[model samples]
Target chain A: MNRVNGDAVLGAAIVVASVLAVLVWVPRDTGSAIVEVVRGSMRIGDALAPTIGFSLLGIAGLILMIEARATGSTLRLDRFDLVFIAGVGGIFLCAMLLMRWSGPLAAALFSDESYRNLRGTLPWKYVGFIIGGGFMIGTLISLVDRRLTARVYLLGFVVALCLALVYDLPFGSLLLPPNGDV
Target chain B: MDYVLLGIQSVFSNTAMFSVFGVGIPSCLVTLFLGLLTGIAVGATPGLAGPTAMAVSLPILISVFGVRPDALLPVFGFLIGVMKGATVGGAVPAILFNVPGTPDAIMTTLDGHPMAKRGMPRRALRIAHFSSVTGDTASDIVLFVCAPFLAIMVERFLDLPEKTALIILSLTFISSVMGSSVGKGLIAVALGVLAATVATGQTFHPRLTLGIDGLQNGFPMVSAVLGALILGEIFVTLNDIWRGERQASTVQSSHGDVADGLQKGDLRRIMPHIARSSVIGTLIGALPGVGSTLAATLGYTVGRGIHKRRKRPEDPDFGEGAPEGIAATEAANSAVSGANLIPVLSLGIPGNAAAVFLILAADSIGGFNPGPAVFNFTRPQINPELVVAFGIFTLMALGNLLNWTIGGAFMRAMSVMSRIPIRLLLPIVLMVTLTAIYIQDTRMAALWITFGFGILGFFFRRLDIPVLPFVIAFILAGTLENTARQAFSATGGDPFFLFRSATSVIFLLMAVAIIVFLGRRKGHGAAATHPN
Candidate 1:
């Protein structure tokens, strides 16, 4: 199979998954809630609108896949391509995991009560961001440039610090991550 | 006439003018400079967008300014400056690194990269800057003149059914024209609407959340946009860099100086292209949902057609480092920045993402609620919203002036700004994106939504799907639903209510015609070019 065809297959698979999730899984799980909230005013047609939309989207994806398969625009990924994908995916995964677990991790590291205090836990939260963000960025830079340097790490650290500080400003009464209460 | 006079008077009203930092600096001027500088910085950076910059700053600015009447102009001044500044700034990366900061600048890279390769990078930058400022100024004038009139017309003729049909027509037309395949474009719009349907407005039970508490308010607009547009693009770039298909190269290695400005002959040659493109940009901008990317693409095509018709031996080859090519794309895209406000101010329908954010700010800040109500002439009482809108127009004018005078120099300096490797830059961008979303929504769940949507965006882009239709659809989803529901209920659930209205029927037919015509044209083009 060519690359374009491969890409189309992957896209079709995604659309199919989305269609099931939107049309079936979500509706089944939440339909009762919707019925209760709308007081049964929600018509079958209204409820089915989004499902129809996703179904159409799936058909469109299928068309694109068939066209790509016919055209035969294909390519193969080399080692670097895999690494790049992994790097980005890894970063996203890591960041999501960090944001998710940092609160619980903080609670475990300290007392639950202490971890609950946002002002007190902010420094530790910053540390988590800096270390995690710096390490991933540094690794990616080293891999791409074929050399490790302090500049990328230093820049990452400074950027993370600035981001944390700006977000923590008193303007909106906003706080950075590890914001368990919010 | 009185409204026009009030708008002009409000531009200089003391109520809107204030000092910054307890210094004598005017608040409007200070905010304009700061917003423009931030906009230029963000726009010069690849993988960032104007709306992203606006989104990042919006909540913070709202918090700082509060929703007080006195705070309206300062907050909106900054946002308006950013909107205009970013359009001019996006050209910097396109000219310097062959990497467009915004999708609208993709056309710029064609002739711009070649010009830079020929060691006239500064010349290209000048052409871009000159055309952008000129186009922006001209479009702003058009917006100033036409928006109120359009708003009055819409108010008079468009009932709920007609309005809803108009939106549907816009969605259909935009989806049809954006991508190579109509199916893919419509699919993108559908998916966008689906994404938006989650935790959205409905009369019945909360829909599509799957019982998740965090999904109740739906995906935060900032998170969705940043994830899908900014972070997703970064992911694509990472893969390209890894595949050895692209490099994190800077323009510092290319020697150029801004002291070499555009010659009179160069200006004369590109003048027609700039003029024609600005008009095209303004016209398209007035249409709801069509964006700068389309404007830029159409402008370049039309300019090329014009150049071909008036072919002269001295004319630069249309695609071979032509100054006119740069002018056409830059002017059209920049013109879109101002003209986009037309629909927003007149009809309260945001024409593009930037205008969406502009409306968001105005809505949140409590002073300017855009629509025909803004243009409402209340005797013995001035409309504050109208005044605020005028104030924003004044700030936009100031921004254009600054862009004309110093935009080239700013872009020149940015040509070598931040030699930070993409590997490093991407991660920082990631951090900023996360921080911005987290601050705005204050929820870890929002971050997850962003990441998930980022992945979705990466895949969509990978399969050559257009993202704009999806974005426009998502942003307008709530409006679409509410309008349609209102129209239906107003007609007592009559299925043919839309057909009963002449305007609604016309709009729906136009939508169908657009789909059929564009789809057939696309098929013919594909057959001619890529016969199997």
Candidate 2:
């Protein structure tokens, strides 16, 4: 049996993806022709650049696979990498969701008006960012420290608050996080 | 001559003044100082880099001073200040903690740590500072003299087809030189081009956006770039920390108390090394995609050879508390900062990540376009872009002046930053970066796109694919497509428009030759290693 290294596996995956992008995705997504005549002058279309890029990508992938097969160079992607990515990604998604929702939730629970009306106000604008940003920082720190402490959470909130003030103090026009969305 | 005067005048003009101690100071100068201070702190931090600081600060700078023409100088001044200060500050950690703050500082650790242990830390630091400032000033002088002339030549000679071909050559060169393998680099460039195609500019129809409304307008340039370069790095660092792949250095080297100031005789001894290394660094930096690490290695090797031949019985050997070694490495790496701007200011091509941020700033601000046309002196009218270019040069000069005067003191003060844990700092950086991006874009979709690109960047790093090629290619894709389209139309629908001119044909042929020659050489080496 012949042994295949991780570079070969990665290259083969890239080749497959590139082929799909060129044949399936590009045609389906791009609405314009590769060459179009506009006002009686021939011009390169929207699709040509991407088509060329994907084709080159495919060729490069093939070359990479061939070279990797010859070289037997290994690329390490262990289970730990997957878990770390997933964990970090989960934290990011949760933080974003909290950032998106905290302001609206605050307005619904505390204020008579919608988040849209209260977004430009002082305390209301600071709510979502402090909650979400603080949570992200604190949780990440805890993840690193292997233990969650109240001091970490407090530090996170303080840092988030400081960041908010830093942006909000001088710049009247600038909106912080969920406030802009609201 | 008029434009030069105008540019100098623009930088010093009373526009955008801030009051300090009942006296008016130029805001740009103030921002430049602040940026220098921030850069020193960032550089002294072990895992932080200049590009990361620039990436996080750019959107904030833009938001603070809108995108007006007046904002260009202040913004550029800050970025340039950071670039200059970071170069000087990177040696601090290498000297004090035996940890290189930046990649180029890897060479500095060889002799610097030894000098510190020998109770000459201050002397080693002085040598590094003097060498760094001198090399930086020398390279800045080269940039000042050479960039305009190169731009003039490119303007006079290269047409659209030739320009297109030049960009193609640059992309090919960057891909070939950057990563472990040319094929991987090419893949990175191709992916960058593909990512750039999602933007709805330069064509009648939106292309490759997958019917997403947020992507219809395109991924925010700042967000995508910051995500790929900065956030991606953070992700990888965090993962390493999580998986116990990275560990903090617990060994503490005591700073011995001794008279460690650089004596006048020491300066004379290291001067030749500094001079030679600065020249080597300047030449290497001018090439696209080649960076300071190579310059540092070459400088150290050459300096060691020269030192060996001229060795005195009393003098310390190279890499063993040798002041000349510190001078050579610091000078070489620091020199790259100024000469790296040659491609950026003249050809509108960024050779490295720092140059990429500068290009991004100019692109976002929209008053200046960097290219051959920037130096079109034929026009009787005052060229604003030319003046802005000179303003940038003036800012760089001012940055060097600051570095010469106060950069050493500031850098030494920032050594405390190295003690901060990377695991703690990176997450905070991630938050700050996300916030900065959010404030500029004011859209959730932009953050999502940034995260997605950050993931892609992580994969690129993990797979040993170079990110600089991808970034340079992404930035250049629009320009290349626009130039190609114009050339194709101008040549009466000729499909072979890239080969229409001799210069362009040569450029195209060079691009192909580089790929073929380098790729085959790499293949032969691989085949030799793995004989079946």
Q: Please report the candidate that would top TM-score against the real structure.
A: 2
After superposition of all CA atoms, the RMSD between model 1 and the true structure is: 4.2
lDDT of 1 by residue, B116-182 (tens): 7777888888899889889999999999888878877887888988988887887887788776667
Task: Give candidate 2's total backbone clashes.
Answer: 0
Q: What is the interface RMSD of each candidate, in Å?
A: 3.9, 2.2
lDDT of 2 by residue, B1-532 (tens): 7888888888888365677687768778888998898888888888899998998899899997789988899899889988988888889889988988888999999999999988888888889899998999989999999999999999889999999999999999999878767789899999988888885545545788777777788777787788899988998888777777776432354686676688779989999999999999999999889989999999999999999999898999988989999999999998888999999889999998989999999988888988877887756777889999888888888898999899988887887888888877888899899999888888888888898889888888887888999999999999999998999898988898887689999998999999888887877886786665
Best by DockQ: 2
- For each candidate, what is the lDDT? 0.73, 0.86
Each model's TM-score, in the order given?
A: 0.86, 0.96
- Those runs of model 2 whose alpha carbons end farther than 4 Å from true positions after fitting are A1-4, B14-16, B19-23, B201-204, B248-253, B521-532
